[model samples]
Target: MKFDLTEERQMLQDSLRRFLGDRYTTARRNEIIDSETGMSAEIWSQLAELGVIGAMFTEDQGGFGGAGFDIAVVFEELGRAGVVEPFLDSALIGGRLLAEAGQGEKVEKVMEGALHLALAHGEPGSRYDLNHVETTARDGVLTGRKAVVMNAETADLMIVSARVSGDVADQDGIALYLVDKGTDGLTIQGYPLLAGGRAAEVTLDHVRGTELFGADKGYQALADVTALATVAQCAEALGAMETATALTKDYLMTRRQFGRPIGTFQALAFRMSDLLIEMEQARSAVINAAGYFDTDQRDLYVSGTKNLMGRAGRLVAEEAIQLHGGIAMTQEYELAHIAKRIVMADHRFGDTDYHLERFIDLSAA
Candidate 1:
């Protein structure tokens, strides 16, 4: 019956909010987004020192928290501040994958923000399918390109997936390797993302890598880590939606029309009410997904959550823009950045259509 966050989680949320509020102004976030790296090393270090990175992992993994709620809590704050840092890449995905590979020291460096990690799994045309790894490994070298390898440009290490045994799409043939940043035959074409952050098109030509897991264990680990990523993303979208609605509300309340606040109009009031309802529903889905965590039932909840949240996020973004007009689209404002983040979240991990099909498939099973 208790739907509230645990006391520790609440405290973590408060601390993150306070820190970001004090230091991460809208202008500062915009500057980071505009930077070549699309992130800030100094800010990243501050967050790590505040225990933000460590909060995303379990105690057994040398972190104080690793529950699904823990991830949701941390990511929600990140999104609220429009943080473009690689916390999701470093902690929820990479840190956990390192733990799975028994690379505890690397994980420690990650928690300390001394290292960054990216998972180079999705290849060209992969389109959010975790099993569609076309990159190949042979004779101790990896070849092929990884698409949208988030944070790979800055990552000291990458967890690359390659097919070692069967067809590219075969679930059983995928393996994972740890490739160092400066490895021979490894190349990255880094680019800033639309919503903020850096990703790369990583090319490997017989690149040497330390084997992390063979096909036997690789697929399951990749799947689990991806599911965790999906959960974190959905929580982030919820935070972005919160910002969008708040911004829209402020605009409506303050922007006078015909000598009256536009928010006083019944039609606008009804629409704002509808947006709030949708947001609450999205929040419910996030809570449900977080509760399932990484268990067998996790896929079901995550799929449902991602599907619903994606749709709701799009609606929130579009509606907020309509209410706020052209100003909402300008980069000078916080809502513009927040709205973009909300809308783009649907495209990552899996989109609404993908997760809806996945949810139905799981339900039938």
Candidate 2:
């Protein structure tokens, strides 16, 4: 249980931190978020060139490191920097979905940052269930609306889920289709997420898409890919918690209250200690999930880790803002965005409630 990065992973971590630290500053991030795609094309290209995207996959998928720890390493850095990039969607989730569907060349392009992909799985009222697809695909044509698909606007291609047969909630009837951007009968209405990304409400009216995966196999692949994305997101939240805690600690020491720094107050000091402990616990959960990511125990660990991270993220967000008082609420300050991102991260994939139930069910089984 000595959860330390290997020599190569350490190098990768060091390089990513340095690169993001230098370029993705608060001001620059704001610019990117306000951009049309909610991401920076220049930064995306640079990251791909630096092999940051490639590091998340295996050699067969055209990446050097596709381990669970590799995913944790990459996303933790992304969280630390508060980057708004679509790496999570395009590179991690969509890229792997393509590969799992036997589309290696597309994954290669995704790793290269030349192509972007979105997984259009969640539909209206799906509420995080992988098999709750109501969209239909017949004769290679799709019909139905997908709600809140991440990175949809930037994706050159999207893997949409549909039901070719059986009832909507039945797990066996699920299928996946590959739809290109600007395809006929495909309409996307995208908006910024509360965190730092873009999502779209997609409507397909008899749109034809290539079948990447069919009934009986699509659900499991979606589950596995979503599980991996969950791990990456939890790691990202851990990184954000680290940044928020550090910012609070620094503020405590420097900000004056009465005759001395507010950190001297015993009550404030205790709260800060609690925040640190919660953060460490969150880190442990992320490490555990990432370690078990490729194993049979992935579901158990992922659910438990996500549930912990969600609660911990809320705690850190609230405590950090309270510790900073009025300054933290200001849009110009760093903590404002970080705090928001932490809370919003909880709601993505599954929130605290969803993961807690998932953990209970999986444990019983």
Question: Model 1: runs farther than 4 Å from truth?
Answer: none
What's the TM-score of every candidate structure? 0.98, 0.98
The 0-to-1 C-alpha lDDT of every candidate, in the order given, reads 0.90, 0.90
Candidate 1: tens digits of C-alpha lDDT, residues 1-365? 89989999999999999999799888999889898888999999999998898998889999999889999999998888888898888667999999988889988998999988999988887888888888889966999999988999888889999999987678998889999989999999998999989999999999999899887889999988888989999989898888889889999999998999999999999999999999899999999999987678989999999999989999999999998888887989889889899989988898999999999999999
RMSD of each: 0.9, 1.0
Cand. 1 Cα-lDDT: 0.90
Q: State, as a TM-score between 0 and 1, how close model 2 is to the true structure.
A: 0.98
23: Cα error in model 2, Å: 1.1
User: How accurate locally is residue 300 in candidate 1, as Cα lDDT from 0 to 100?
Assistant: 97
What's the lDDT of the predicted structure labeled candidate 2?
Answer: 0.90
Residue pairs of candidate 1 with colliding backbone atoms? 57-65
What is the clash count for each candidate, in the order shown?
Answer: 1, 0
Tens digits of lDDT, candidate 2, 56-113: 8888877899888999999999999898898988889988888787788888888889
